[model samples]
Target: MIIEGVKLMFVGMTTVLLFLSLMILLIQFVSFLTRDATARELEAIQKERELQSLKRKKKKEASADSDEDIAVIAAAIAAFEAERFART
Candidate 1:
């Protein structure tokens, strides 16, 4: 009788384990399906952000070049003004 009970217990445990493993696999599959679309969307957003960063960098470079040019012009004007003052 004890042997029979042990066998029955083993069978029950085996069945429970199998069912649990199956459930875990199902859950993982469903999660993958749900997140796959979101993952693609996140990738697209990341690409857009990188593109925006590049554009900002270009703009900053352009502004810096313009600022340098303006400084050169201002310095030239200042020198011209000093020369006129000395002449007067």
Candidate 2:
């Protein structure tokens, strides 16, 4: 009985190892076939990311410029109010 169990375990382990090795080989073969397509997809994704980053940067710069303009306008208004109060 002990010998039978050991033989069963060995067979099961060997079968599992064989299946895993074949799966690995199949994956390698598929990857080799699709390598060019995968590279193109990666390049396109990178370009899209770069464009999005550039758009975000431009938006940030515009927001900063607007903040400066608002500060200038507020300063002008404050000066006008001070002058008016002084005249009164």
Best by lDDT: 2
Worst 10 residues of 1 by lDDT: 31-40
**List of clashing residue pairs for candidate 1:** none
Which pairs clash in model 2? none
For 4-37, candidate 2 gives per-residue lDDT tens digits of 9999999999999999999999999999999999
| Model 1 residue 25 lDDT score | 100
Q: 6 in model 1: Cα distance from truth in Å?
A: 30
What does the lDDT read for residue 81 in candidate 1?
100
Q: Pick by TM-score: which candidate is best?
A: 2
Clashes of 2: 0
Candidate 1 at residue 57, lDDT?
100
lDDT of each: 0.98, 1.00
Question: Any runs in candidate 1 off by more than 4 Å, and if so which?
Answer: 1-30
| Cα lDDT for residue 26, candidate 1 | 100
